[model samples]
Target: MTTVMCMKLACMTECTRQGIACMLTRTVPYATVPSFQKQDLNRTMDLGLAEDHFSRPVGSFVASDIEQLKLAIEECKKLILELPEHSERQKDTVVKLIHLRLKLQELKDPEEDEPNLRILLEHRFSKEKSKSVKQTCDKCSTIIWGLIQTWYTCTGCYYRCHSKCMNLITKPCVRSKVSHQSEYELSICPEIGLDRQDYRCAECRTPISLRGVPSEARQCDYTGQYYCSTCHWNDTAIVPARVIHNWEFEPRKVCRSSMRYLALMLSRPVLRLKEINPLLFNFVEELVEIRKLRQDILLMKPYFITCKEAMEARLLLQLQDRQHFVENDDMYSLQDLIDISSGRLSCSLTEIHTTFAKHIKLDCERCQAKGFVCELCKEGDILFPFDSHTSVCHDCSAVFHRDCYYDNSTTCPRCARMTERKQDDISDVKEA
Candidate 1:
């Protein structure tokens, strides 16, 4: 009777413990599995199951599916914690976790179902001011007559879309200054064929057929990527790659992204033409003249920076639109090249150069005092390093008449005197 009582007491205690364990499992949201049982869960985080959840054609996820996804995400996080950091397996698990979380968020958030959109970058949209030019929505392929339908244009990229379609644009605006400021893709229409892109639109991943059975694929000249009609819309823009590699100014058909990127890069002054294609300057007469003018601008910048009177008068503001011209001689923006071709930039620079020259040479005595005298000619007339008729010494930076420099066998008088003085000092040091 004593032995029976002891066994019954132990049995009752075990049952109570088991009931409490069940309660804990039900209460804990993220009940972690024991290390020994993790092997059993290797098949629980099925990638195919996650892909199926995302690949659903049209309907929202059911409550049960969402709950399952949350559980799977928790499982994935636990698995990730067990793996070594930055390992390939851990990385893959992390990606799966992200997908699961995105799926869960999409299911829970009703905003994802709404037509309102978001983009990869910010776009500053303003009222479409031009009434005469017929514009179209970059998002939807529809003409936007300014007088009839209200629209907005992105001041950054010149992206025009209907007022309703503004929120619908998912493509980012061109922020060339923030991205690709120094480096530009120079290959001319470096198109990876449709086979390489798997015959899909680069932006939207929409199916594109070669023969236009369902959707036609269009090529963007700038990016060399294929796009569907909705993303292309037959928009034309001068490709920077073509301009750099082939010097082709003829506008070519590009996708919406390329169009916006080029428009924003128009006046950015990021391209170093001399570094990219020095041969262009030799062929294009305007480039040659522009280079000379830029050199003169560079020389004038120091005088403007130093003179209190020049600063007070805001002399540098004359080239406010082309501030980079004063900063460096080689960098030329795409718009600068276009304006040069049309004689607009040349005329504008000529006017600015005249104004600068008047101040540096004739107007400001302080600026005139900074001018270089021709050492070879020994003339009272001041010579500037930027003067076309002058030659600057390589060693001492002394200016002289080009003809006089050649006659003097390119010998600088100042450098010669300094060399003599150095030799005399060396002789005295040796004697001492």
Candidate 2:
């Protein structure tokens, strides 16, 4: 009638009392009724495995080795049986026994086999191949995240594990591990590292321990910022393995390249880049390219003479009454270039700049009409764009800040009211 775990403990207890010649249960017995499932952190109890599948403490301490484990388990159980129900030690003893039993079973069969882990470690140590970095094994929950192959997560359930941990997994296995092509591409986001000692996980609300290492958080490169590891993993567009990948592809270059004219977009009601004037974009791109070409030419001057420059130097400088012609040419002045401007590509650099400046001024006026900037601080854009809180003077048709007018107000500064009043007084005096 004794439980199988109890019998194992009883036998170990008798080992020290060998002088008493105690007869112990020889065969490991199974219970007809199963043990109650213990609740996990996720609150789901695993009930697939049967009780007594391995030797464990029914209600005792278990240590690293079998002998010490047996002794500790037996002692705890004895105290539990003798102590009062309300004994504080009794509850702890029960919890300790549960932990030890789980540990005992764990040593018997690891979640990942030795061969798999060894190969994974070997792959990690291999040189020359570019691989995503990692430090923890979510499967074992024992190994840190480093030196593992690319993580594999269930497409259906999001159960993640080491690449080596997959073969041991059964069906539900759809396709094989994507060792090469399926490497996750990280999103355009930031991996924020924090130095603070105390903080809670933005997802779980659990306090993050900063015992030895810097705390890690994910940040959105665009709008909303900051996410804890868990929230960053599950909810964020960028995955951990992909975070490093996308950073090189986006942000530093793409933001400025593709979105170089982002400021122009603010004027549009829809706020889309596609709607921007093509002439403006083309002109900007060409200007940048031309500038780059000029720099290259300057850089190569010591090594090679460019054809256009060589022609200009040898023919034009030598022949065209050169100094006088250069002095008379108004190629440098924007207005003169615009007056003489013709074909699209034939436009002089000065003319191109003139048109670009005009476009910007129009866009600025449009933005101002949309309340993007304050008329009172019309020159604020010389520093940074300011928001509008406009107040208009009806008498003089001038606009300024609502706050400024209230702060110091009642008269329109530009109306010349006082001067007009003096003029009226002089006229009245002459009439008298």
Candidate 3:
């Protein structure tokens, strides 16, 4: 009863198969003009690159080029069906784009399985009772927005995909296959609901503002889960995870990944608050105050990041022997660092911009020498060790043995600051 009309110049072939016929012979209605018309698909008839990309791998694209590649991939996928069957290199280009996209995705996230890495969203919908209702076809990622659209979403991972896409999924889903609500409780208490400005879509890291009301957007069956509709559909996995919301910083946008990472870091007893840089500490401290101010300073889009974040993610992705970028670097939202040398977060950031390990010292050199060399460490007294011939430097107000000072050098170690001040004074006098 159905037909797949192949408009070939040689054969003018027609195949009467149910699904194949629907793909080829289906007519777009007048009402659904631009969004889902069969005729409108021809807009991608000219989707060809100047240079061949079959040989190029996605890994070859550096961090700076990955953004453009992602855009190109989206465009190329749109062109696959629209390109004429006889179009030169169209099929080949799409194949190469698919290959590159997969490779790039793997390279972008090398560590496919990370312990701390959390899933932002999942397909939380149940299977449909019948196929009578129309919905977006998953294989093509196109949906017909009607008064009512029906679809099947895996309750386990929250993947609401078309039946075709679901059947074609080769792997058993990267996300968890089951929801263990009893085991993993809501770590952070969620709001009565969420607003667009208040919550970020876990998958895309964008605000969850659907039209004006945030609740128009969907949420998981679980108590604390919330994400934009875009993240909900795009997600292929369902990792039972909790969200971290900052009630204090309600208005200023912060990535949900950042919130999750912060929660992850808080769970880490190894990292001490003292070990963090003052600036980082200030950022954490300022988080509570940011809500008071009425401005959005953060770049909210996770996929589209600033140059600094792009470079950081690029360096992280190029690692030689890591399953994935460590310490939520793959999230690319927050910069959580640990001293590789000290192997701990006990060190403090001494310099504004320097190697985290080098600039960050566990303790001052004087504190390190405590008990071993400085007997007066933490005593607020001075040490004197020379056969009862103790002396004190008036300039430094410190008691020391006469031998501690260089021969005829009146200043002690503590008085070096005064000596510099004096030298600076002399220099200023001469200059003046």
Candidate 4:
């Protein structure tokens, strides 16, 4: 158990060590611990003794054990400060420190600490563009010198600002609830007026004037809100409203907020194309093709899941990026619709379908064993739900040759056998 725990910790350390070190250097300020204590903790960890005891369930920890863990965590933090920044040893130490802290927290309040259940919507800030690219801070309305000045850009809302100004800004990240709900603003460029916005930039509140030779006020094609050049760099994006209402794929100018919000919702399978516009499938050839492929993928999902060989091979990884294809047949993402219009998604789905088909039909005997035999002909030939010529009974979901079912004119042999057995049992029960 000790060796196994050590190995698991080593694996985790290797994976997240670099990220932890980088985060520490960028964000966390240093505080030093005693030298003797740091040395003792490092020696304990190296010997795998810490893993053996601390790796047990948090509920097993007594008060003394918890206090020891707290001290060990402080020692680990001190060790991290002593080591050089971004070094492999420093990264490894950071990982251990994080694990110790988490263990302590869980031991303190196992029942109350449920981080996963909380809904905390906040900015996911990251450096934007290249260091050479010129950009402005959305918070202070000042130029962020990319070559020297430290700045952050919210990946959620594209809210660019100085690193210091990031926490000071009161504006929350703009995330549309469109994915959680089916309703969307279906109108195209629903502009009220700059007067409605008080003639100021919608994001940064910069004053706008249209009296010049060319208007400084830039109108976002997605939200119809006007913004200054800094807040809206005329970044082109496919508008969800336009795509849903008109099946338009033309990229239009959008503000940073709309750009980031649309990006957050890119792969979410919220757009029920059939419910919104069933005629779209008929009008667009690729949409029709994609829908068929998605349906086939859904059919093949059950076969792959039950087969051991298919699981080992990860046959479903073919549709890894487009997992929503396997999830539901009717739902489509904004990106999926956009790609379908561009003639890319159908070809990709065709390739993925071919791979999935190969595994379920030809490659694995275990998967093939799950196929259904035609009850009508009593033949050895196997029929699958996804097969083009096969027909499935609506009531019992039994598969058979389409011609054989048509010949019987809606009577399924399997359903008839069950009915006969049920009647025989009923008659026997009455006699008894």
Candidate 5:
């Protein structure tokens, strides 16, 4: 009767211990309860404890020690609850360890419905498997190294996507190629321009151009269709679109046409190359060479001769000077003469020479002044001995003493202009 009573007490103790463990699993939401339960059951089974032995009287079972078993289970619960939560890397390590422990527990039990634990184990293993897979950039197809943080996997191939490029995704096209082998070989091709094959722009049934060649192709997480970068980026609603060139062309044809047009304009028969002013001739010759090279032709296009280009071709063949007379009053300066010669200035060279001659005189009109002046002042008083009177302002003339101008305020007395007095002018004025 004592053995039966003791056995009943031990069975109650074991049940309480298992209940506490189950309660702990429920209280800690993040804890892996299913794994811990399996582990406890396996350890109990390993100790050679039968399912019925748990119900046997404590005194009857010499192998059973209830106190020791209770102590071990309490310690395990304390350790699980006190597990440290640290950095993400440390957390991952702990999770992996937990998964390994759970897997070992699963191996011991063949008939446990531990789906949650299995899922956690699978997630942990998948990360390890992905580390071995090579990843490349989707846009450039460049290989990546180290822990890939921003990569997506599609159809067993891994591709690294930039934050902006994450939106673009498409499925790869499969193609079959025949080689020397008995059967055709299957090959993978990037799916680009697939949509254009069937669908056409509503207004113009013209096929849209794709922007870039496909490097990495996968199904779009959002749209679920294969698309090239060009079509994907374009606004589909807009039809009959115009395209702009982004590339600059070398030896541009537009420039060549412009140069030819400008050359035709400046080639005039009346404007003789040899007769042109040396400076103007050099400028036109340099311009012609530049036209031959097609440099600066863009700026010269607007100034090209339109009507004169066609007329001058025939006129230039018969090289002749078209000369005309000019009235005296019609001319101005040397610049005016050149302008007239080039048909730019409306006046004649003869008019220009006549207008200039009126202002210029061969002999001195004032005092008929020539040769030496008075010896004392170093100026000539009179041109001839017969001429006794001064014909010029005496203050500035050779007849006057240099000091005389100073005595009279050092100014030309007749013209009221400032003058430098001579030494004789000072002496003569002092004597006066």
Candidate 6:
């Protein structure tokens, strides 16, 4: 049977060599198992014939024709087989190359009947150009593309930035309770070349923008005034004279507008009363004289009598005259007079006597009764024996019983001191 098959194969090879088209077809009944079996056999035979044709060398095959693709596939298969057994990746690469070659062959042939490759290429190129034409971010000279939903752009440069970078350039989104409008305000960032010439509060160092100010308003706590809210409230130079007098004398009535004029005039370093309103010019001149006299008194005497203190003295004198009180009367002590003179205590003698009667304790050293407890410990049981002026920390107020090393120590657990030298060093490092 092997000898017979060899003879038949040789005859078929000779026939194919002679340039005769070999026609090997078999017919069978449609409703028979032999028909399906014959179809399968024919398919296997056709595949064998195709494989035999592709097994030829490239030079032997017809070049510049569709038949060259069959030769290329054979060459790819041979190259894959020549690679090392473990080189599966190389085999796949060769397979892809074969597929690309087949595609190129399809693209070259007009009679092959396929879509025009030039049109597809043009369409793809145009799409890419349109996508890449827009401006992109260059963060440290790196281009970022696409319409990032959460990103924002710089108004000047049109460079796309992350939300956080945009926020750094702009102000924080603070919600206002009174104003229902949603405002998008940008804060000036000096680092990013935004305007930063606006003034800030000297005490708190908070930025003061001019946008919120009314046109008539010239003075502000945060801006050129350089005074924070707390500092402004405590400023004696700018406070109205009526307010100052009211703090010293409770029962007196004063003109508000006149007091404001006086405060404004006093705040100036150099002033002439003639330049002000003519009606109050004489009063202003008198006030200037009184201020000079008070200054002379303070210079000559050890005790300081401020404007508030003088006002309190005037009120006391008025009260003394009204009540027909005698100077050396045994009805009241010097301590009682001092308390009334301060204007902090109630003027009513009965109330003053009652308050002192409950809290006063006799000092052991002076043998005198005192109402004030120790300014440091605030223990009413022990009276402060020392009469010297003392300053203490607000937290503990722990005054030394006697002069000691701890009294000189300003370092506290609550509030630590930061020197100008340390702040200067920090600023230098930040600049560097």
- Candidate 5 lDDT by residue in tens digits, 230-270: 22322221000010011111221111111222123222222
* Whole-model lDDT per candidate: 0.71, 0.34, 0.36, 0.70, 0.29, 0.31
Model 3 steric clash pairs: 111-323, 122-158, 123-157, 123-158, 123-159, 124-158, 136-143
Which ranges of candidate 6 are over 4 A from the true structure?
1-391, 401-432
Alpha-carbon RMSD, each predicted model? 22.9, 26.0, 22.7, 18.2, 33.9, 34.4
Instruction: State model 6's lDDT.
Output: 0.31
Q: Lowest-scoring 10 consecutive residues by lDDT in candidate 4?
A: 111-120
Candidate 1 regions off by >4 Å?
1-137, 142-170, 176-182, 423-432
lDDT of 3 by residue, 256-334 (tens): 2223323333222232223332243344433222211101111111211323533454522422222122322212112
The parts of candidate 4 lying over 4 Å away from their true place are 1-121, 124-135, 140-143, 155-158, 164-170, 175-184, 204-209, 212-215, 377-380
Local accuracy of candidate 4 as per-residue lDDT tens digits, 1-432: 234435544454444434433433332212353464466445646633344356656446678888888777777766667665565456556556656665565565343322221112466676544553256777666655443345666654566776656656766666534344434456799997889988888877878866632338889998888988767778899898889878887899998667777777888777888887788777877777777788888999998888888888888887788777778889878888888888788778888888888888888888888889998887857889888888889888899988888897657888988899999999999999
Give the Å shift of residue 358 in candidate 5: 75
The alpha-carbon lDDT assigned to residue 52 of candidate 2 equals: 27
| Tens-place lDDT digits, model 6, residues 1-432 | 234334433343333321222222222233542553455334433433223333334342245544555555565554445444444333332433333343333333222222222111111111111122133322222222221112333322233432223323322111221123321111111121112324443333345433523211123211224322322332222222222222222222212221222232332222222232234324334333333322332221211122343344342343342231212211222223224446332335434333322322231222233223443334434332222233334454333333331454545432333355568889999999
lDDT of 1 by residue, 1-432 (tens): 234334433332334333423322221111364565346345443533223445335766678877787778777767767765554455445544544554564555433323333233577776655553245677787655443345677666767787667656777667744464545568888888988888889998889977885799888888788899999878899888778767778999988777766776678888888778888877888889988999888977888899988999998898889888888888888888889888999998999889988888899999989998877778858988777898888888788888898888745898999899999999999999
TM-score of each: 0.64, 0.21, 0.20, 0.64, 0.14, 0.13
Ranking by lDDT: 1, 4, 3, 2, 6, 5
Error of 4 at 79 (Å): 56
Better of 2 and 4 by TM-score: 4
Report the alpha-carbon TM-score of model 6 versus the true structure.
0.13
Q: Model 6: how far is 212 from its true place, Å?
A: 44
Worst 10-residue lDDT window for candidate 5 reads 238-247
Candidate 5's C-alpha runs over 4 A off are 1-82, 87-95, 98-131, 135-173, 176-245, 248-432
